[model samples]
Target: MSQKVERYYVPAQSPWPIVGAVALGMIAVGAGNYVASLPDGGGYSGYLLLAGIALLLYMLVGWFRNVIDESMSGLYSAQMDRSFKQGMAWFIFSEVMFFFAFFGALFYARMLAVPWLGGAGNNAMTHEVLWPTFEAVWPLVSTPGGTTTEAMGWGGLPLYNTIILVISSITLHVAHTSLEQDKRKPLTIWLGITILLGLAFLTLQVEEYIHAYREMGLMLSSGIYGNTFFLLTGFHGLHVTLGTIMLIVMFFRVAKGHFTPANHFGFQASSWYWHFVDVVWLCLFVFVYVL
Candidate 1:
């Protein structure tokens, strides 16, 4: 018996990578300039930011189309599938570290910095000289600069969004199982429900932000508490938006009969991303909202 050697498929050089890099560069520069021009109301940097975003979207669509064509043409081997799996896993790991850094900052502020500023562990002179009036509360509603803001409680919109995300994860899991069982109808229905839940979460979050800004005075400039709160939640919202887009793509592919019970890595990848987003939200609810 002779062993057959499987040849690896190497794709030709593509311009999408360079396009993506340029898009990112433009976004960075545009965002920096826009922020710097905030005092003057606005500038042309906003237009550059929008253009970069449009270019990024174009690159994503083109790159994804090429990959889909290749996959549908049966150009991907088992080795190629394994490679994709590894790449996705590493990408997810990078996201994990990104969130970890934010959480670390939160922990350091809550556990160490705030306490030190409040005269904890023989720092009485430090507190007296720096911010003697600072209360050193967890939410820090009153800043040393005399700016006061209300803390966003864990009730109402936050709680509802938490429940919605939890349900979305369950519905997505059901969709995955239905796909594996070849139950197309249930799969589509559950996936659609999941997408609606995701949309609901995002909508509620927007309302929450509006309430914070209009009524509570909680904003990006509302001292340390507000800064961390917005940074963490805003970045998480961006992730949720991206995850929803991925699910929408998957939904369209499913409608076109793209995935099967046996070979559905694309679906699996999207599911994994959705689950990760759900988990991140749970953590945010606990630490950022509840605690």
Candidate 2:
């Protein structure tokens, strides 16, 4: 006699999901409008924006909880596991594209925009008539508009942060290894330490940003240099913030016995995301700060 295989399926109907979609749609539109209306000092629509965000987050939690329950109940089949893994891969690819767009911008600024502004190519008059003191450089410590800022050196807080993030990456990998080998205590300890390192990195980043603005006069609106600097690292910082939240969630799950050596896609996905963010920061440090 052969064992009959059964497939797991969640019925394709959830009213809460539709509600969440509408809520998120509303929040996006309302938030844009609220920001636009800020100059006029009017709009209670911001409240709608807030409510929508709250509702959307609630919906996400409920939906994920339902899925988690279904999975833990052994309802998921090998087919479902493959689907989940593929979905995660696609999500990571999308994230890579997002970062690529910014990286493209960084390259364009360094290769074209800065040089053109300093009177390269067709802008000979631009060089002779203005910004004669400018030099083509990355991170662009000074701008044609006369705003100057000290480029962060790799020797100080930035170097230390680099070391911390790199160590965190190593720790995350260690956690993954231990989880695979069924070493729960080491996995948890390493993961917890990784989370702490992430937090420390964020704290140091905040301090660096403050120091740049207050002591070095670097600001977002100062010039193209400042604009690119803040835009690149600032967006990376946002990703770090989000990755940290994911890690925190994983920590809770780890402590509550959520994942297993064989069934821990959530942990793996988070680790991948965290590593992606870490690598991006290293590029930013090398290109936008150290270089």
Best prediction by TM-score: 1
Model 1 bad stretches (over 4 Å) = 35-40
lDDT of 2 by residue, 64-136 (tens): 6777778778888878888888998898798889878887887888898878877778787776666667776
Model 2, residue pairs in steric clash:
none
Alpha-carbon RMSD, candidate 1: 1.5
**TM-score against truth, every candidate:** 0.95, 0.82
True-structure RMSD, every candidate: 1.5, 3.6
Candidate 2 stretches greater than 4 Å from native: 1-8, 11-60, 128-135, 141-146
Measured with C-alpha atoms, the lDDT of residue 247 in candidate 2 is: 84
Lowest lDDT 10-residue stretch of candidate 1: 34-43
Top-lDDT candidate index: 1
**Tens digit per residue, CA lDDT, model 1, 56-156:** 88998899889999999999988999999999999999999999999999999999999999888988778788887777779888787898999999999
What's the lDDT for candidate 1? 0.91
| lDDT of each candidate versus the true structure | 0.91, 0.82
- Candidate 1: lDDT of 48? 90
